[model samples]
Target: WNYQFLTQLGYPSNYYAAGEMTVSQHLEVSGQPDPYNPGWVGLDYIFGSGMRGGSSGGPHIANLGEIVDSATDPGQFPDRNTIFAVTSWGYGLGNSSGTEIKIQGASPLSGVANANNFVDLFNAACRRSRAHFGTWTCDLLVP
Candidate 1:
């Protein structure tokens, strides 16, 4: 959605603000990253936007590029790339340039099946929430 803005010089077309996708990679975290997981949790990392406070659930999307990046509807969900993760937290504030986003898959459950199981835990949480209304369920606590 590019639009021409009126300028002081009356040119009205000097600047353009087109939105595009950025690239990043996934890596393992070492330090005491998340407070919820005080122990070793095998958390992963990736360079992200300068996301500040109250931006926890934003998606970290990667455009697959060209052939796979074509947008059928120009702008829509699942258009050109996949969301590998979401904005978790900023690593203790300084400059946001070195900030790395933590993916949601890694956990301290310590098992082959525990990794990349947010969907399961989330679904379980939902089910637990539903069942709790009827006194037949428990909390799905993800570790």
Candidate 2:
């Protein structure tokens, strides 16, 4: 999911938009240094999207669809509709004709460098939420 504003729309309009994108690829991008800041390491998934701005930091959900029963389709993990990433950035070309083709990216929730750290952070957030809301239901499914 993303909230993007078409650059052509110009400012003053204050017309921001929201939309969803299909995961064209679940990339395992690791060990890459940030081009802008060499000291930082990068890990993310790159996918296709339209040419609009302000989509960064949106949640990228996984298993986002109707659930099938285990009896009908066994060997399925219990986690469904889980957000596994957030929109990081997008890059591509655009023309004056307003036909823009761009690709976006996000850092995956797991299976990369510092994955354990990510898990810890998630669990910490869950714990904080549980405490703040006075509910014991906030928990992370850490495999």
Candidate 2 scores a C-alpha RMSD against the true structure in Å of 8.1
Tell me the TM-score of each prediction against the true structure.
Answer: 0.31, 0.54
Q: Tens digit of lDDT per residue, candidate 2, span 53-135? A: 65565566555567756575544444555666666666666786868666666666665655558878878888888888866
RMSD after CA superposition, every candidate: 14.9, 8.1
Error of 1 at 67 (Å): 3.8
Residue 103 displacement in candidate 2 (angstroms): 1.0
**Model 2 pairs whose backbones collide:** none
